[model samples]
Target: MRHRYGFTDEACAFFDFFAAPAPELADRTLTALQHALDTATLDHPRALRYGRLLQAYELMFWEGLREG
Candidate 1:
């Protein structure tokens, strides 16, 4: 996907995570999501809501990869 500011090579490659040619891209995205979940906290107001959203994204990614 092109943008006015343009994407970094890594960012462009990330979009191809579902491609079979490089499954590692998907793995890396999953790992990053896992890390975000691990370090997430509820120390601030409305943090719970954001945390839930992040958790949901992680679950979706995990299931997507698993099903593929």
Candidate 2:
């Protein structure tokens, strides 16, 4: 997938992060996402570029849960 996107070698590792096992938190997937975003920021500063997108994902996830 990284190759398909033409991401550089350094960025390949950042893309690999999506393969990590989803963090488990019972009914708090939002918290899990927060944790992921934090870890991504720490693990790959470049991830900062996606902070807003990640926040959007978190919002959408919470909305889905609320409407569930």
Overall lDDT per candidate, in order of appearance: 0.68, 0.64
Off by over 4 Å in 1: 1-45
TM-score of model 2 (CA atoms):
0.30
lDDT of 1 by residue, 1-68 (tens): 44755777687676566444564768996786677678883244465687689879977986996697
Clashes in model 1: which pairs?
A: none
RMSD of 2: 14.2
Write model 2 residue lDDT over 1-68, tens digit each, in one string. 45565778676675355446556644485676579787774444545557678879967976895697
The alpha-carbon lDDT assigned to residue 51 of candidate 1 equals 68
> Which pairs, if any, clash in model 2?
none
Off by over 4 Å in 2: 1-49
Error of model 1, residue 47, in angstroms: 0.7
Worst 10 residues of 2 by lDDT: 18-27
What lDDT score is found at residue 37 in candidate 1? Answer: 70
